[model samples]
Target: MPTDIAFLAIAEAQQLYHWLPAALELARRPDVRVSILSPSDQILALVESYDPTGSLRRVRLRRPPSRPDSLFRQPSRLATLLLNYPTIARFPTLVTTEISSAWLRRVPGFRSRLILIKHGAGDREGGYKKRHRDFDLTLVAGEKDRRRMIDRGLCTAETVAVGGYPKFDLKADRQRFFPDDKPVLLYNPHFDPALSSWINHGPAMLAALESLTDWNVIIAPHTKLAIKAPPIVSSAPHIRVDMGSRHSIDMSYTMSADVYLGDVSSQVYEFLIQPRPCIFLNLDHRDASGDAFAHWKLGQVIERADALPQALARANDLQPGFVAAQEAAMQQSIDLSPVPASQRQADLILNFAKKGV
Candidate 1:
C-alpha cells in the first residue's frame, strides 16, 4: 500500500526553499506517494527541477486572480483548502512548512496528520506559540527548540521531533554577486516592523554602505519587508539591493558574503554556518541580558547607522573573538547529526505514518 504524503508549499516562492529539500528526499522513497500543493507556478517549476523525472505529484491551489491583499487572501486560500478538503483528506500525512496549516485540524472529518517543518532557526519570539502545539507532529531544528516548546507548554516531547535545519542540506555555489573582489556584506532584515531595522534605519544603512567603498553590499531584506515597502534603489556599483530574488532565498548571499549584517532574521544563523563575521542592528534597543536578544551575543551589536562603517571595517578582526559564541549559537539553533537532516526528516515522517503519536 502506498502511503499518501502531502507537502504543502502554499506560501510565496521564497518559502519553497524551506520545504524543498525534505520533500525531494521523501519523494525518492518507493513506499511513499509524495505530493506538493502550491499556488505559484514558479515554485512548482522549482520543485520540478529537483524531481525532473516527475516522480512527485504537483497539486495547484487556486488564488484570487486579482492578487488581493493578504488580509483577504488568507480566508480565500482557506476556502480553497476547504473546497479541496475531500482530496486533501485522502492523504494520511500532510506535511507543511507554513504554520497556517494548523487550521486544518478544525476541518470536519479531516483525519490527516499535520506535520510542521519550521522554515528557519531564529530566536524570534514567534517560534514558540499556542498554534505550534496544535500540530500532530512538529519537526524542529534542534534540542533548543524542543526544550523551549516543551518548557513553554506549547507542545510535548512525544509530538515534537528534532531533525535539524532541513534548509542547511541545500547546496549553492558561492560566486560573488558583485563584479569586484571587495568583501561582501549581506544586510538581511526581518519583516516584522517592530524589530526590523529596515523600517527606520534601512535607508540610512544603505547610504552608509554606499559611502564605504571598501566593501560590496547586498541589501536583501525578508520577502515580506519588500512587499510592505517599495524597492530600495542604489546608485553605487558595489551595492546590490535584492528584494526576495530567487538568489536571496537560495543561500547564495549567505554562502558568498564574508560578513553578515541583520536584525532578527534567521538567515544570520545560515551565514554563521561557517562562523563568519557578523554585525547585528539593535533597532529595538533590546537588553543584552534578556533571552530574546541572545543572538546578539554572536555578533557586534550596533544601534546607530553612523557606527556601521567602523563596524564593517573591524568585522574581520572582531569575528575571531565571537567564533566560540557563534558555534554555541549554531548548536542551539541547528542540529547537525551524522545523518543528513532530510533523511532524518524522511525517516521521522515515515515512522510517524506507520505508528501514530
Candidate 2:
C-alpha cells in the first residue's frame, strides 16, 4: 500500500513560502506521495517556478468569492477543505501552516491527522491560544513555545515537537531595494489594529523618517494590512513603502536591514537571527512587565510618536545595551539545529504517520 501525505497552502500566496521548503523535503521521500492544495494562482505559479518538473502533486482549489452572500462566503481555507473532502480524506495526514486547519477535525468522517507548522516565532499572545491545542501535533520553533504551551495546559509535551522554523531553509536573494549604501531600516508593523502601531502613529512615523537622511527606510507592513487599506507612501528619496509585495515575504528586508522597527510582528525574531538593533512601537502603552510583552525586552520601546526621532537617532548607542538580551531571546525563540529544519519536519511527519499519537 502507498503512504499518502498532503500539505495545505490555504492562505495568502506569501504564506506558501513558509511550507514550500518542507513540502519539497517530504516529496523527496520514496514512500511518501506529497500533494499541495492552494487556492491562489499566484501560489501555484510560485510552486511551479520552484519545481519545474512537477515532482509534487498540485491541486488548485477555488478562491473564495468577494461578495459576502456568495456560495463560497466562508474563507478559502475552510471552504476548500470542505469541497475537496473526498480527495483530502484519502490521505492519512494533512499538514498546514495556518491555525484554522484545526477546524478540519470537525468535518464528518474526516480521520486525517492534522499537523500544524507555525509560520513565525514571535512572543505574541495569540500563539498561546487553546485552538493550537486542537491539532494532533504542533511543530514549534523552539523551547520557549513548547514550554509556554505545556505550562498553560494547552497541550502535552509529547503532542508538541521542537523543530526549528522551516522557512529558514528557504534562502532569499540579495536584491538591493535601496539606492545608496546608507543603513537600511525595515519598518515592519503588524496588522492588528489593537496591537499595531500603524492605526494611530503610522503616518506620523513615516513623516518623521522622511526628515532623517542618515537611513534608508522601508515601510513593509504585514501582508494582511494591505488587503484592507492602502499603505502610507512617501516621495522622499530615502524612504520606500511596500504593501504586501513578493519582496515583503521573501525575507529580503529582514536580511538586508541594519535596524528593525515594528510592533507585535514575528518578523522581528527573523531579523534578530543576527542580533541587530531593534525598536518596538508600543501604541497602547501596555506595561512591559508581562510575559506577552517579553519581546519588548529585546529592543528599545517607544510609546509616543514624538519620541521616535530621538530613538532612531540614538539607536546605535542604545543597541549595545540590548545586544545581550537580544542574543538570549534569539536562542529561546528559534532552535538552530545542525540538521535542516525541513528535513527534520519531514521525518517527524513520517514518524507520526507511522505511529499514531
Query: What is the TM-score of each predicted model, taking all chains together?
Result: 0.94, 0.93
Q: What is the C-alpha RMSD of each candidate to the true structure, in Å?
A: 2.4, 2.9
**Colliding residue pairs in candidate 2:** none
Off by over 4 Å in 1: 65-76
Model 1 agreement with the true structure over 4-107: per-residue lDDT tens digits: 88887666666666677777888888888889876666677778877878988998766545464231123245665666677677788888887777778887
In the range 295-345, model 2's lDDT, one tens digit per residue, is 888888988767877888888998989999988887888898899888988
Candidate 1's error at 341, in angstroms? 0.6
* Highest TM-score against the true fold, candidate: 1
TM-score of candidate 2 on Cα atoms, chains taken together: 0.93
